[model samples]
Target: MLLINGKVLIHNGEGLNFVKADIRINSSTIKELGEKLTPLPDEECIDLNGDYVLPGMVNSHYHSYTNILKGTSFGEPLEMWSLDTVALGRILGEREMALSVSLGICDMLRSGVTACLDHIPHLATSHIAAKTYKNTGFKSAIAPMLHNVSDREILYEINEIYPVNGKHNKFPSVKDYVDYYIDFINRFHDPKGNVKVILGINSPQRANDELMKAASELACRFNLSIHCHLLETRWQRLSADNDISPLFKLDKFGLLKEQTSLAHCIWMNEDELDLIAERKAAVVSNPTSNAFLGSGIFPLKQYIKRNIKIALGSDGVNCGTSNNMMDILRFLLLLQRTQEMDYTQWISIEKGLQMITKNGFDVLGFDKPFGEIKPNHSADLAIIDKNSFLDILDDSFLNQMVFNASISAKHVLIDGRFVMKDGKISVIDEEGLRREISAIKPYLGKNMRKALNIANEEKKIYKSVYESLLISPSNIQ
Candidate 1:
């Protein structure tokens, strides 16, 4: 495949520059780059017609399980929202799981995101989602959320506030979950397929020491990245039992390392930030979700100043409400501007571009070179119609992209294959997925309604307990 006559952004580690060039691809890897390449016989040629080509953006953190549950909750903080969405959203069968994951990836492809780290809470149907990605030719790192706490236990903790009686579902033992993750890794880790597994600890508050140590050992043996949530809410930080910070505990267990990527570090203090930077760990911020769930703003300037590798994520469709990285970038840029008073403290458009691209590659530890367009790199790229939003002869493309929230990809290529062309997905069954989702709508609705009723009954008790804990409504609203 040969792509010609495109304005390409070349980032060669030092800086970014624009060049009019042609790219040659052999199978899945980029083969050559120059002004005008003589095409070989039978080579598929595509004329970009002066369109703009950029490396596909990477979503460092995401959740496909809630892809089917958008707009289900409103005006609730992360804690309360999870009670309604995530707790209830897990009630999905294999077929529903497959369709939902496919739809999520389709949305991502349309928005020019070619890679992601999908943090799945339910282990039962994660393989089904993985299968959908494999068939659709998308890249992902699937990390099943590992936590020892059972739903019944959580309900009990909430019940202390209001009185409700119910039996909790039986959960697998700690060893059982660990063995399942190892089995999942052995079965699904494939570099050629562009899909792999990572170790996941939902949070230190939910996972026990045994599970954390076991996950650390397994990740070391396999040399995989460990994904975790760190201080997303002030309530979460206050709820810690001991005086020790969660980062300290994680570090003590050898889980805090260069390969680990922490998500939503919204409530980290100065000391925690310093420790993370010292450990050379990476952080991913979900600006839209943090704002939607009323979680506090992440200290973007602090991370940048400390030299902590930062990446951006959309979080989940249910919370962030969109898979579009363009929108996420806009929100991130604006939020950073509003949070810091110093004009120089805000993130620049050039730096923001790297956060979604090259910085993400470093956080995810992808074996192949990606997040940049160059010779011998994976041919994962997005083509945007320059005329769609920009005026003729206007070279301020970065400013237009960062300030506008409606920009989308005209075509997307994953590993040299056209996953989306002419603004439509070509590699997956888009219509079939739509039909399946429509067919299952009533059943999912019925199940979720029942779950919501149960949540409401329990919320009465949970709310009073929340008040007793003195959790500010703004924190979890």
Candidate 2:
């Protein structure tokens, strides 16, 4: 396939530059890039009609289950929000899980995201989510979470603040979790295919020694990458008992390595930051989700100074605003600026763009080079109609796309195949998907109401704990 007459965004030695080039794709990789390239007699050709082509963006951290739960929750802290999400997750069977995954894919492709690290929280329906991604030909690293601790145990002083009479819910045993992962890996773990399986630790404080050890061994044996939540809130940071840092705990289990990507390192100290940089691990910052949950801001300046690879994520759609990487990038660029006083030290548009694109691919640890529109790179490109957003094209077009424009891909390709073309998704029957979702709305509505009621009761028990921590003195710097 030959794509001609397009303004392609390419990274020169200095920075990203736009060049008028024709891209030649052979199978799943880009073969050549040049101007006025002629097409072969038997080759299919697509005229981009002077559109702007970009490397496909990636949603570094996301929860596919939350796609159906959008608009279901007002803003709440991470711990409190989890109550509602957990309840809702319990009601979703295989059918609901598939539709939810499909819905997230449709939302992501419309906004030019071609890949993601889907950190699934539910173990029962995780295979459903993975199969959905596989069938749609979407690139994803499906991570079924592992954590035996209850929510109350991970929050600092929550038990003390609101004492419970009986024991908390029993989680699956370490052996159970490990066996499940092994079976899941054997069934769906495909490093060379569209879907891959990675180890998902819910959080360090939440996992016991046995589980962490198993996770480390599994990762080592399978050569899998690790993705998990890390210190997203002050209460979570305080949950590290006996002055032991969460990073140290992870390292003790041999889980902190280059292939590890921790999400939401917002409440970390300089020592933790240095440790992450030294270990060559990556951190995914979800700006919109942090702000929405009232979690502390990520130390972007500190992370950048440490030379840690930082990528962007949208997080859960219900917690954050949108699945759109462009929206996330825009929010991140603007939000990070408020943290730095020096204008010169603020993140540049180029750096922000990299976070949503190449940095994400780095975090996923895919062997084949992607997130670039160059020869030998994976042909995952988003052909966008810049004219839809920009009336007049100029040098500031990229800037406008980041800050002012409403961005959507006119055509999206993943692995040299069109998943979305001419503003319509090609891999799935979107109209049928909408109808399925609509057909179940009444059932969903009834269940969601019950879930909210359950969440409210749970929230009452934890509300005082949340308030108490807000006024407590902090030792963390």
Candidate 3:
């Protein structure tokens, strides 16, 4: 296939530049790129008609289960918000799970995101989510969550405030979790294919010694990448026992390696940051979700100074503001700038673009190279219609894209095939999917009300304990 007459964005060592060029795709990779390239006799030709082409963006961290639960939360801290999400997640059957995954895919594709890391929290319907991505031909790394510790156990001084009763909810054994992962990997894991399985430990504090050891073994056995949540809240940072950092604990289990990508390191200290940089691990930051939940700002400047790979993600849409990667990137750049007094030290638009594209590919650890428009690179591209209102200069195109424009893809390609063409998704029956969701609206609404009630009741049980922690002195200090 030959794509002609487009302004293609390419990274030219120092920064990004748009050049008028034609791309020749052979199978799943770009075979050639140059100005006015002649098409082969039998090659399929596509005229982009002066559109702007970009390397497909990636969402390094996301939870697809909450795609259907947007606007369900007014506002709450991360610990409190988990109650509502956990309640709602329990009521979703296979049908709801499939629809939810499809909904997230549609939103992402329209906004030019070609891949994502779906860090799934529920294990029962995780396969359904995997199959949905596979059938739709979407690029994804599905990480089914693993942890046995109850929520109450991970909070500092919570046990002192409310004595531990033997009434905590039962979880699957370590053997059960390991067996499930092995089966899931054998059935769906494909490192070289569009879909892959990753080892997802919920958090260091949330997993016991046995489970952590099992997770490390599974990751090494399958050669899978590790994805886990880290210190996202002040209370979580204080939860560490004996002044030991969670990063060290993970390292002890052999889980903190080059392939590990930790999400939301907002509460990390200098030593932890240095350790991450030394180990060459990546950090996936969800800026919007952090602000929505009142979590502190991520130390972006510190991470950049350490030369750690940083990628952007729109965490659960129920907590985040949007699914668009551009919006996420823009919000991150603006928020990070507020922390820096020197204008020259602020992150540039080019770095922000790299965070959404190149850094994400590094975090996913895919076999083939992605997020580039070079020869032999994956032919994952987003063709966007140039905005007449913002296309005043070649140099200012990226600036307008990051700050002022509401970017959407006119055509989207994954592995040299059109998943979305002419602003319509081609891989799935989007209209049919919407109708199915509408048909179940009444059922969803009823269950949602019940779930909210359950969440409220659960929240009441821990409200006083949470308040006590808020007023308590810092355990870390």
Counting only residues 3 or more apart in sequence or on different chains, how many pairs clash (N, Cα, C under 3 Å) in candidate 2? Answer: 0
Task: Write candidate 1's Cα lDDT for 140-189 as tens digits.
Answer: 88889888754334332452433332335345677888789888888888
| TM-score on alpha carbons, each prediction | 0.93, 0.97, 0.97
What would the per-residue lDDT of candidate 2 be over residues 1-477, giving only the tens digit for each residue? 999999899876767877789999999999999999999999999999889999999999999999999988799988898898898888888888899999999999999999999999889989898888889888998889999877575567875553443366568989999899999999999878788898999888778888999999999999999999998987778777444677888999989989999999999877899999999999999989999999978888888899999998999999857989988989888887777778898788888899988899888766677888889888999888957656465567788789988788999999999999999899989999999999999998899999899888988878778887778787764
Please, what is the whole-model Cα lDDT of each candidate in the order they appear? 0.80, 0.88, 0.88
Q: Judging by lDDT against the true structure, name the best candidate.
A: 3
Model 2 spans > 4 angstroms off: 161-166, 241-243, 391-393, 475-477
Cα lDDT of model 1 overall?
0.80
Residue 402 Cα positional deviation in candidate 3, in Å, after optimal superposition: 0.6
**On TM-score, who's better, 1 or 2?**
2
Q: Which candidate order results from sorting by lDDT in descending order?
A: 3, 2, 1
Q: Which candidate do you rate higher for lDDT, 2 or 3? A: 3
Is 1 or 3 the stronger prediction by lDDT? 3
lDDT of candidate 1 at residue 446, scale 0 to 100: 93
